[model samples]
Target: MIEKHTSNNGLRIVLENIPAVRSVTIGIWILTGSRNETNLNNGISHFLEHMFFKGTNTRSPQDIAEEFDSIGGQVNAFTSKEYTCLFAKVLDTHKEYALEILADMFFHSSFDELEMEREKKVIYEEIKMYEDTPDDIVHDLLAQASYGGHPLGYPILGTEEHLKGFNADTLRNYMKEQYIPENVVISVAGNTDDSFIGKIENYFGSYNAEYKPSNIVRPTFLANTIERNKDTEQAHLCLGYDGLPVGHENTYSLIIMNNVLGGSMSSRLFQEVREKQGLAYSVFSYHSSFLDNGLLTIYAGTGKDQLPLLRDTIDKTVETLIKSGLTDKELTNSKEQLKGNLMLSLESTNSRMSRNGRNEMLLNRHRTLDEMISEIDAVSHDSIQKVIEKLFNQSSSTALIAPDTSG
Candidate 1:
């Protein structure tokens, strides 16, 4: 059973009770991330996520870690392009303790000056680590090529210069503006009881309810290619096209179309490019949907000499799908594949907590498991073809990292 409640200050709480499970996963979802940042504070969302674990007024960082370890619980957090989440999974008996610790971190983080300085160095090293990985950095380049000047294009990990500028005041000011009761969702799933809501209310009910409307300019897609010559062995590439935002009617159809095109190991790109031609080792397609826009991207890593062949194969595969569409067998197989994956993934308490939290955060509503299955099942051949035609006809932007032969 699933239940939802809203506190007087506007904090939304969602709970899923699975009597069969022995553990519960609780998540505090905040509606702010890299997209809410400016050039001056590009990576503050992620930086702040790291600082949340450093300490609170009542506990030191070591105390926080040791407590979770003693309880045999798992605690972590991640910052994305649109939001941040701090979450934990623990035995059902430890629910109150888990929530109390999270509440303390959320309400009382001190952001010590020395800790902030030390964390900046850690993040700087993280940035350097990502820069050294061409396959990883290519995706960031693709975002820049696709969105250009939009905040969506900025790296989630800000530049070293920007990181150095963030002190206690900078973090506090940003948090004051972004972290309010109205901008959060608390989700708990698994072997939970009716008392969970009251516990969440007690911890988070007193926050100020403030809404700050964002004035970010929506990004326009630019069809251009960017390339960097490196001394690496494999040439990494990402091809991106404009896609639909979340909750659009055509999003489901697009998912089906993507699956048949390049999403699965049995997908056309994987079969034709890697299995048949042996052109590339890693090949797949994925779509990212944000509040106002989306991106459909295909990625491949291959030998520099095989780049042209790989590109031609991908282009041909897309053209074939557009012209001929999917066969009945292909459509049925893809739908079942998607449905099975969805059902199997929800068996975990963590997945259920994430799904409930993200749905409430992004769509402001909950979709039952049956409703999602119905949506995927209702996708028709005509709908898939239409989405394919619309998506494939658009101009695409490409980002490439190739080995430099000039040396």
Candidate 2:
């Protein structure tokens, strides 16, 4: 059973207790990211994530990393367009220490100017790294193509122009606007105590400051193609279409639909395009959904010569899905695979903690494994067809990054 509680300050807490687990994983989820940012303050969420690890008021940077390591705990954090999370996995005996470090980092961050300036350079290097990599560049292009100029579609890593001007004030003020009690969820899984939750509540209860504003202008469906010429061995391609939001009931149907399309090694896209035709090497499909919008994307990498054949194969597969749809057996098997993956991953405390926190942040509620199993099992072919029709039955925006044409 998954237990849930709403604190007086409007913080949501979800707990999952499983016996036979020797470790505990906990996460602090702040429900703000690039999607909530404007052109002026974009990437500040990701920036702040880096700064928190630089040092906190109570701990040095090395202290933070070493303390966790000394206790054999795993700690890390990441930011996305919709959320930022800090997670830790530690032996059950060290649960309180992990929670203490997490609370300290959350509320007492110094955001020191020296560290701030250094981390900016680090992030700048990271930006360079991503820009130099063709595969990374392609996904960003796909987002821009699918959502146009909306904040939802903007690159999570703010542009070079935006990052250059981003300073400590830019980050602190953005944090002030976005990191509020009303927009936070904390989760812990494994052998943990109810009283430990109270300690968390006590620490976070005093955080009364109203956080950053969220004037998100949702992205609209855009139809366009963007091609970036690059010098690379393999051409990277990404095509995206409109999809359903996370909270929609059709979400499960779309999950099933995506799986039947290109989700597995045995998937039609893989079998026909890679195994039989001997195309380049990689092919996959995925769905990215938010509270108000979604995107369905298919990605492939092949030589420029194989582009036409690859495109035709993808188009034919989609057209076939639209016509005949998926079978009962395929749908059943896909759901079982998905369910199995979820269950299998739960064997790790870190996975459970991250999964619980993210789901609560996304859905604003706690759901048992049984609830998810039922939801996936209840998905039907007709329902999936309707979802597919709504999501991918039209023209989509494409982003292609291919090698220099002279080759």
Candidate 3:
């Protein structure tokens, strides 16, 4: 059973007790990320995520690491476009100690000036690393082309100039505004007892309860194309279209459509573009659903001479899917594929913790495995057709990074 509790101070707690398991995964989710950022502070959320592990008032960075390692546990965190998460996995017996350490970092991080400056250089190198990898940078470029001036378009890793400008106060101000109790969710999955609930409440109950209204303007889709000439051997391409937001009714149908289109090894794009015609080495499609909006993207990497053919092939694939739609056999196979993957992923305690945390943070509700499977099963061929028509038939933006031929 999944249990939920909301403290008076507005920290939402969710727990799924798996009595058979000897371990637990706990996640602290903050509902703010790049979308909440201004152009001047585009990557503050991600930067803060990094700083949280640097040290705290009572614990040095080494102490934090040593404690987790001593217990044979793991601690990590990540920042996404919509939220940031700090999480740990430990034996069920060690959960209390793990939570204490996490709470210490959460409530008492001491973003030392020296560490801040050093991390800035580290992040700058991270940004340059992405710049050198065209396959990775092409998606960021496509996002910029698709969303234009919107905050969603900004890379999660802010520019080098922006990183250089960020100081301790800049990060603290952003955290002060965004990281309040009401904007946080704590999720735990695996072996747990009733006492665990009270413990979590006691740990988080004193936080300030505050909610700030976000005035993020919805991004408009711009079907523009951008090309960057780099000194690389292969051309990397990304094609993006507008997609539905989280919890949209048609999202399941769109997922099914995506699978049949280009989501897997047996997908049309992979089979046709790579296996049959030998036009490209890699080709796939993905859908990203956010709070208020989403993006459907297709990516392919191939030699410069094959770029035009690859683009045309992908375009034709979309045109064909929009025109012909998926057959019943195709829909059935895709649904089973999605269901198998979903069930397999849930076998991990960490995956369950992440699912519970993200659902509560993003949707404020929990969806049972049965509920999700039913939704997937209920998707009809016509529903998928409609999704393909609605999303893929629309205008799309393209981004290409190719070797610079000009002298």
Candidate 4:
């Protein structure tokens, strides 16, 4: 069973003690990400994420890295569309040390002006790197089109101009306002006990102020023209449509549709595009949803010569599925594959730690493994068809990336 507690200051902690597990996994999840930024503030969340490691009041930057390296422990962090997370996995004996280090990184980081200036150059290079890669750029173009003018449509990495303008005072203000306990949660798994819970309270329980999340109004969906023209050899293609958010009843069914559409090698897109026609090297579909909005995108990379035929093939696949629907065998197989993947993830203490945190922050409840397996098992072909029709209708947005190979 997973234990949950909330401090008077609104700091929520979830503990799942796995006795036989040899290490402890500790994580801190902050609710701010790209979706929460303003135009001037875009990418600041990601930039701030990087700055957290520079140092803290009690730990120098090198001290932070070496503390765990000396323990044969693993430490890392990432920023995504919805949240930022920092985690560490170390021997059970070092549980308190891990928590203390994590807290210092989160609450007391010194965002030096000198360091921020240097990192600005690094982030600008990162922007150029994304532009140089067709695969990365296509996804960026897709999001830009999917959400249109919404902040959610903007790239997670703020533009080069914005990064140049960021400074320490600005970053410190952003952190003070955006990274707060009212919008944060911590998840831990392995070698946990009441003492572990007590230590968490001692370290983090004091930050429990009633901080309100910033208010930003986003549109329900976007229906506008989106096209990107780049000088590349192959035309990148993407189409966006509506999807259900993560906790919806039909979310699992949409996951199945995505699986069959492009998720696995045995999927329809792979078999049709790669095996039968050999028209493209890669093609797949994915379902993405925010707290209230969602997007289902299909991406393909092919030459200008194959553009017409590629579109036709993709359209044909969607039309066929909407009409003929999925077979019981396909549905059953996809579910099993998904279930197996889910179960496989539980084997790692790090994966479990991150899952336990993100799930609660997103769902407000922890679902048992059996409950998830049963949900996957219950999806039927008829329901799958209904979801496809709803998601792939004509009212979707399309964006593409291509090279000027003719030039």
- What TM-score would each prediction reach against the true structure? 0.98, 0.96, 0.98, 0.96
Every candidate's lDDT? 0.91, 0.85, 0.90, 0.84
Q: Model 4: which ten-residue window has the lowest total lDDT?
A: 218-227
RMSD of each: 1.2, 1.6, 1.2, 1.6
| Runs with alpha carbons beyond 4 Å of true place in candidate 1 | 405-407
Question: Candidate 2 — worst ten consecutive residues by lDDT sum?
Answer: 205-214
Across residues 1-407, which tens digit of lDDT does each residue of candidate 4 receive?
A: 89999877787899998898889999989888888888888989889988888888777788989998988888888888888888889999988888888888887888877778877888889899999887777777777767877878889898988787788788877777777777788899998775687899988888744466568675566655556678888888887887887688888898988899888899998899878999889888888877776888888889888988998999898878888888878888899999999999988888888888987888888899999988998899878887988886757677877755455
Give the poorly placed runs of model 3, Cα more than 4 Å off: 405-407
lDDT of 3 by residue, 1-407 (tens): 78999999888999999999999999999998888898899888989999998899889889999999999999999988889999999999999999999999988999998988888889999999999999999998999999887888889988888888888889888888999898899999999976798999888977784578877787888898989999898999999999999888998899888887789988999999999989888889999999888899999999988888898999999988888888879889999999999999888999999999988988898788899999999999778877877786678999999987565
lDDT of 2 at 304: 88
Task: Provide the clashing-pair count of each candidate structure.
Answer: 0, 4, 0, 5
Instruction: Please list all clashing residue pairs in model 3, or write none if there are none.
Output: none
Between which residue pairs do clashes occur in model 2? 176-212, 177-211, 177-212, 178-212
Better of 2 and 4 by lDDT: 2
Model 4, position 84: C-alpha lDDT score: 88
Over 229-277, each residue of candidate 1 has an lDDT whose tens digit, in order, gives 9889999999998988888888888888889888999999999989999
